[model samples]
Structure formats: structure tokens, C-alpha cells
Target: MSDLNTSRRTIVKGAAWAVPAISVAAAAPSLAASPEPTPDIDLSTSTPGAAGVVRQTDTQMNISATTFRNTGTVPAEGLVVTFAVDSGQTIEGIQVFGSDIKNVAQGATTSGYGTNTVTLTLAPGTGLGQVTIAPGSEYTSPVGQDILLGQAGAFNLTVTVQASNATANSVGYMPAPQAIPA
Candidate 1:
């Protein structure tokens, strides 16, 4: 019984010393390795009066044309334009604020011939609407406004030139952003 008591006392004393030593070693590494805390970086005022741009409310499609018809009088390449608006606004029709249709050629075939394609890309924003190519007297039939250009990253409109050997051309437009009534 005395021997067991002495053994227990020795074990308790050993453990008491070992506990503090183990704790000191474990904590020492972290305490010595850590450096002073870093100061936080201030991102405020990154751009003073940076609110000068319009807030993007809806997504928009930017239109562009490529490879238009090569009629007898080379019909000029039609222009493609872009417009934007806030969400839920109805797009009645697109207006051509500007245009440049000047291409002259003397060929054997029609004016609006060959496969002319128009491409539209969606710029980063919110809402979207339908796009169509309105018809003209000598132009091909209007491509309907069935094109729901939502967040479709980008879309292409392929126009087969008119069978008419006479001078002809095709241009597409997107509706203007209407003002929301008070």
C-alpha cells in the first residue's frame, strides 16, 4: 500500500510539471511567430463624384451589321445602333437617328442579294426587348419583332438579300427608351 501511494505521488508531481512545460511550448511557437497586426486598407472615395454615370437599369442589345448584299449598285452596308432603358418599359419602335447608306457597284445580279447578316450583342445591364428590321419599298420583308433579346449574351440576324435585281437595301433598328410618366 505504501509503495502504491509513493508511486501515485511521483506520477502526480511529474504530471504537474509536464503540464506547464507542454502548455508553454505549445503557446510559445504562436506567440513568437505572429507579427504585429496589419492596418486595414481604406477603399472609400476610390473615385470622387464617380456617380457621374447613369445607373444601369436594364440589359441592352447593341446591333451591328456585317456582309450586306452586293447588288448591281453595291447597296451600302446598313447601320446597326443600340439603345437602353429601365425595366418594364414597353419598346414601341426604334428610330434611326442617323444613317450612312452609300455603296455603288455595277454588277450582273440583284441589289439585295447574297446572305447579309446582322448581329446584336447584349451589354451588361437589366431589362431587354424585341428587335426587328423594318421593311422599305425596295427592301426585303420586315423581320418580325419576335426576337426577344433578353440576356442572350449575343444574337445574329441573317438576311437573305431580296431576289429583286433592282437597287435594294435592309436596315434594322431597336426602339428608343421611352420616358416613364409621373
Candidate 2:
């Protein structure tokens, strides 16, 4: 009778331990395989477009202007402009479009007479090339013009503008916040 009682107690203890162990093991899989979510970032800014130059008259001295804004949380630097210029006309250099309320009719930065002008000479021939993107560096902004040797009809010019530390989007060499001739 004593041996039988001891055997019964052993069976009950074994069952109690086994039940909890099995339950814990079974529950662990659900916790390990659960899915979690990820996070994202936000950026918003504006870029300048290509400057437009049209023959207001039939002289080599045509009118050109480009307007650019930061439209971001910070300031931009080394803005360059690139465009096609006719070799027939003499490119006198770059001048600022001066007029308060809406400046930059001449060029970029520091308004007033003789204050905002850049002298860029053009080469001779039909395809006179110049970079608003400065020499040695890869990008440019703050527009300027190439002095031409002669005149040619509406040449196709491509301008590239960019900024760093804020936002930049480029389709090939051209970056975002762009303007083009109408």
C-alpha cells in the first residue's frame, strides 16, 4: 500500500512539470515570427530654372535674365549657368537686371551700378560653348552669359543648377528648381 501511494505521487508531479514546459515552448514561435514597421524622412526645397534671353532688338546686345530662390531651409553656393550662344554676336559679359522689388534682371547678388557684372568671353563659330558651372568644379549657379563673336538664330542652350546640404534632384546633369524659356 505504501509503494502504490509513492508511485501515484510521482506520476502527478511529472504531469505538472511537463504541462507548463510544453505550453511555453508552443507559445514562443508566435513571438519570434511577428512583423514590425519602419520609419521615413521628409525634404522640401525649390531650385532655379534656365535663364531666358530673347532679342528685344536686332542687335548683339540682347536682353537676358534669370531669377533663382533658395526656397529651402538653408542657403546655396557656387550656382552656375550653361547655355548656347551664337558666335555672330559679341557677348559683352554678364550684367545684373537692376530694379528693386524684383532684382536679378542683370545677374546675381549685390545690386546697384557696376556692382553685379561678370565678364565672360565666347569663342568663334556656330557652337560657342560656355559653362555657368565654374571651371575645375562640377556644378555652378548664380547665372552669367558667354560673350559671342557673331550672331546666330536661337541656339539651344542647356543650363545645369544644383545645391547641397538641403535637397537636389537631377535628370542627368540638370538639377531641380529649374526655369526655361517660354
Candidate 3:
């Protein structure tokens, strides 16, 4: 009788562990098959009045009131803006404004003001908030104050926008000859 009772206890212990293992194996497939949501983003600038320029000096200028639009199905969050300029030019300052953006933060600079590329992002924190571009909405930025120290007759500017779940959007702008002073 004693040997029989010990064998019964061993069987009960083994079965208890086996039941949980079987349940976990049954759940694995469903979790692995779930898909990620997609957000499609589009960007564009206003025509005939895209940007306003003010020449601070022969080598310094401020570009303001550049408008942008978002025509996606979902809100675009975690926005990152990249500015590319010609050689001998540098972006000095940038300011972004939108209904969904509570604050703006400067991103990590690889070469500070010396490099031709500058990047900025929506500020992230408890109260600082972030920039979220809602579908069918519009946003504007004073854009940047740039220095054309290269003394080149004309400089090209390109802006690119990116988000956490959406593909990147980009647009190019060249100040009209009449817009810039000689």
C-alpha cells in the first residue's frame, strides 16, 4: 500500500506541470500573428506664398510662415524635421508652430551649426508634450534663420518630415529671385 501511494503522488505532480505547459503552447500562435497598424502621411507647401524671407544682412536672413499640411488617416506623432542646406550655409534657429504641438525640442546635433544638415524634434516629457499632426489638418513653422556665409548667389533648401509610424515626407523650396534682395 505504501509503494502504491507514492506512485500516485508522483503522477499527480507530473500532470500538474504538464497542464500549464500545454496551455502556454496553445496561446503562442495567436500572439505571433498579430499585425501592426499603418499610417500614411503626405506633406506639401503652399503655392505662391510658401515662405516669407527677411534679409537680416548680406549673409544672414530669416525665413518665416512656411505652411505644411497632413492628409493622412491617423495622427502623426513623434515628428522629426530635417533641414538640408547648401555648403557654406548654416541653420541658426528654428521654430515650429501647430495646433497639436505643445512644445518643441532641439535634437542631438552631430556638428552643431557648422554642418549643412540640422535636425529638430517634438519635445518629449511629462508636461512638455509633443507634436501630433491630425489627418486633414495644417501646421506652420517660422522655419529658420539661416546664414549664407558662403556668399553663394543662391542657396537651395529642402525640408523633410518623419514620424514614428508613418513614412517620411519631403518638400523643396527655392526663394524666388524677386523675394531676395541684391
Error of 2 at 168 (Å): 7.1
The better candidate by lDDT, 1 or 2, is 2
- The sequence of per-residue lDDT tens digits that candidate 2 reaches over residues 38-93 is 11111122233334444443433233333334333333333333333322323333
lDDT of each: 0.28, 0.34, 0.52
Runs of candidate 2 with Cα error greater than 4 angstroms are 1-51, 56-64, 85-92, 95-149, 163-182
Among all windows of 10 consecutive residues in model 3, the one with the lowest summed lDDT is 100-109
What range of 10 consecutive residues in model 2 has the weakest lDDT sum? Answer: 37-46
lDDT of 3: 0.52
Q: If the candidates were sorted by their lDDT against the true structure, best first, what order would they fall in?
A: 3, 2, 1
Tell me which of candidates 1 and 2 scores higher on TM-score.
2
Candidate 3 lDDT, 1-182, residue by residue in tens? 67646687798999999999999999888779666443365554333234455666666655565555666566655556566766456665443342212233333222234466766555422223345566777655445434333343456666555654565433223333332443
TM-score of each predicted structure versus truth? 0.19, 0.30, 0.49
Model 1 C-alpha lDDT versus the unseen true structure: 0.28
lDDT for position 134 in model 3: 68
